[model samples]
Target: MGAGHGHRLHYHGHSRLHRAPAHLKLVALVGFMLVVVATPRELYPVFGGYALLLVAVIASTGVPFGYIGKRMVVEVPFVLFAVLMPFVATGPRTEVLGLSLSEPGLLAAWGLLAKATIGVAASLTLAATTEPLDLLRGLQRLRVPDLIVQIMAFMVRYLDVVTAEMGRMLTGMRSRGCDPRSPRHWPLLARSVGALFIRSYERGERVHLAMLSRGYDGTFRL
Candidate 1:
């Protein structure tokens, strides 16, 4: 369904980045992000270099800028929260564009912005290049907590099923002449959402049970 949520889950044709081992990519990304997160806030040039590296990676992938921009919107909440550090963080106030800005806040914001962007970019790039299954294998090989890897594996596998189920529920409601926009229908719509949540919860429980019965453990050998 073309990554119905607007996230690019599929990769395009042959590229050197795509051919790289997933563990190597993951390690490189983690190391790069560590540098970004560890750099002093006063080092604006460091952040600039990080951004340039991200741009180069993106360019190498042949992914559209629009796709990156769209995915970055998901980071806005973190960005906004990070931006607030300047107002409330304890530090010397400095004049920037004639406005007093918190010195600590400015640094905090830079730190967060760089870390968040680099992490997201690296992650999205990885996801775009590798299949979901390969990504899971990479994580496992990297010795990511088995539980975390399992959860991620399950989530990636089931996300589409959940999305389809939700879509069907929405379709059923629409087919029944449900007017979600009507004030009178608000209660019904709310109930539908609640029911959907319940159904999803139950489905997860059942799936877990089934997995247990099938000799599933903390890790899948495959």
Candidate 2:
């Protein structure tokens, strides 16, 4: 993949995975996830096999497990939802650790967690090895909608900018002795978010105008 944007998830490397075609990696990712989703929840050992495949790919990429582990926090919500399944879902009960959990729900929870973890890991692996611009170009190669691809391209390009803006806003709030996370100051936080959105929208307009001035033709040329 040709270098373009510096991404937090992208590891700078010259490994074979980094050298692989982005469109092919995207295809393989889709295919791998399909197999994972299709597998029966009761086939516990098979899920382990899927995990081993991911581990092997990850190892070959030369990216540290710790580097990948940090980004795995994105899956916390899925983990939480999976943990609640056995407690709330309707099914025959089984006692384990002195707590009664629904038998079927346990299986469902395992399947959900396993699939979600594998999917996220696979995606992060791709992100670590492929440049953001290359990934977008790959989507274009796969015939995804031009408009959607354009949106994704812009989002990836400007994500760090938006994040920096948010950080500044939070710092400004703190300097004013306002707690952004506290319930009492939530109104201030809400207004800050609205203000941020308007600012970002205006910035986008200016960027579009600048691009048009430079003879941008709607399609990304690389």
Candidate 3:
């Protein structure tokens, strides 16, 4: 991947975590997440310990807590699902704050929220410290298949490109008096989205042909 590819997520730090070998960091992250996942849900205090451990790691990185908090908006869907569980799930009900909610679901939601939050925080921390290219190299070192790594590399590289394309298309739509945000314009928005997909697909094909012409044989250097 290019130097610019994953720089947005990286905080450009000089801490030990920043200098740690990418493969080692990857292994440590997976191990930490596994331990968090395997812990019994009823052992709520253990999750507090896990959260503190992550907090220590985050503090060492010198990345702002608010920065991590802002990036955590991606986990809102998980939060919403967890919030609904107590009401929607089937179980014996209990009262809290003058509301009846499923007892089992309350526990399940707590467990789900804790795990999901920690997982997102850990992954974001990793991204904040490590470059995309280093992560790919780490994957290769771990014997992850070259083809899979290459696909990941390309996906990272193209995310910005695809996003820019979508932005331009949206701009064009607004220029033509089709407001994508308006309910009546949804059909136009959907068609534009379809067009964007076709354009992206064609761009991928052209990229593949270019790579092939340059002696790529189903794989190239990462």
Candidate of highest lDDT? 2
Better of 1 and 2 by lDDT: 2
> In candidate 1, which residue pairs get closer than 3 Å at backbone N, Cα or C atoms, i.e. clash?
86-105
**What are the per-residue Cα lDDT tens digits for candidate 3 across 1-222?**
233533677888899999999999999999999999999999988999999999999999999988888999999999999999999988899999999999999999999999999999999999999989999999999999888998898898888888888988988878987668879888887888899899999999999899888999864654
List candidate 2 segments past 4 Å from native: 1-5, 179-191, 209-222
Who is ahead in TM-score, 1 or 3? 3
Write model 2 residue lDDT over 57-156, tens digit each, in one string: 9999899999999999999999999999999989799999999999888988998999999999999999999999999989999999988998998899
Root-mean-square deviation of every model = 4.1, 3.4, 2.5
Report clash pairs, candidate 3.
none
lDDT ranking of the models? 2, 3, 1
Give the runs in model 1 whose Cα sits over 4 Å from its true position: 1-7, 90-101, 171-194, 212-222
TM-score of 1: 0.78
lDDT of each: 0.79, 0.91, 0.91
> Which of the numbered candidates is closest to the native, going by highest TM-score?
3
| Residues 1-222, model 1: lDDT tens digits | 435542346556578887888888888877887777777777788778878988898899887767766777778899999978888887789988897889878887877887788788777777787777777788889999888998897788778877777778878888988747779888887888898789889999999899899998756776
Q: Name model 3 segments beyond 4 Å from true.
A: 1-6, 177-190
Clashing pairs in 2: none
